[model samples]
Target: MLDNYEDILTVNDLADMLKIGKNTAYQLINTGQIKSVKLGRIHRIPRQNVIDYIIEKSR
Candidate 1:
């Protein structure tokens, strides 16, 4: 279930969860589709944000 994921997720984690490529994960963040926070040069995505993206796409 989505709730099983960590609160803060890395790009790789996002990719695994969504079954998407790493570039596609970056694209989602770059396109403002999935909200993320910057930690140095890394993007940390929230589980809720991913859930939101899922709901948005499902619509």
Candidate 2:
């Protein structure tokens, strides 16, 4: 589904992909709804995590 995105995705990228705001993307990460790795001040989300989130939400 997210073939255009790389294996690792940035919060902004995720936001754009989901058509949501950056705050909402951050909320998803902070709430642990979408798994991510925090590196210093930056967050890296795996492409699979987003796919999983979509699939989970569909269920």
Candidate 3:
């Protein structure tokens, strides 16, 4: 489960939260299903975007 106060999440964190593989999480980001910002070599996903993705997919 994600912390309600978390503002940002990494690919690894996304994988764990979604119960999927790390590569799958990267694919979602690469495919634009989940929005992310690239900071140097690291990708950061906003917590709200993750929640939105879940809501969108559930619909």
Q: Which one wins on TM-score? A: 2
For every model shown, the clashing-pair count is 0, 0, 0
Question: Best to worst by lDDT, what's the order?
Answer: 2, 1, 3
lDDT of 3 by residue, 1-59 (tens): 56743689989889988999999999999999999999999999999999999999999
> For model 1, how does the per-residue alpha-carbon lDDT over 1-59 read when each residue is reduced to its tens digit?
77778999999999999999999999999999999999999999989999999999999
Instruction: Estimate the overall C-alpha local distance difference test score of candidate 2.
Output: 0.97
Better of 1 and 3 by TM-score: 1
Stretches of model 3 off by over 4 angstroms after superposition: none
Instruction: Tell how far residue 26 is off in model 3, in angstroms.
Output: 0.2
lDDT of 2 by residue, 11-33 (tens): 99999989999999999999999
Give the TM-scores of the predictions, in the order they appear: 0.93, 0.96, 0.91
Clashes of 2: 0
Candidate 1, which ten residues in sequence have the lowest lDDT sum?
1-10
Residue 50 accuracy (lDDT) in model 3? 95
Q: Relative to the unseen true structure, what is the C-alpha lDDT of residue 26 in candidate 3, on a scale of 0 to 100?
A: 97
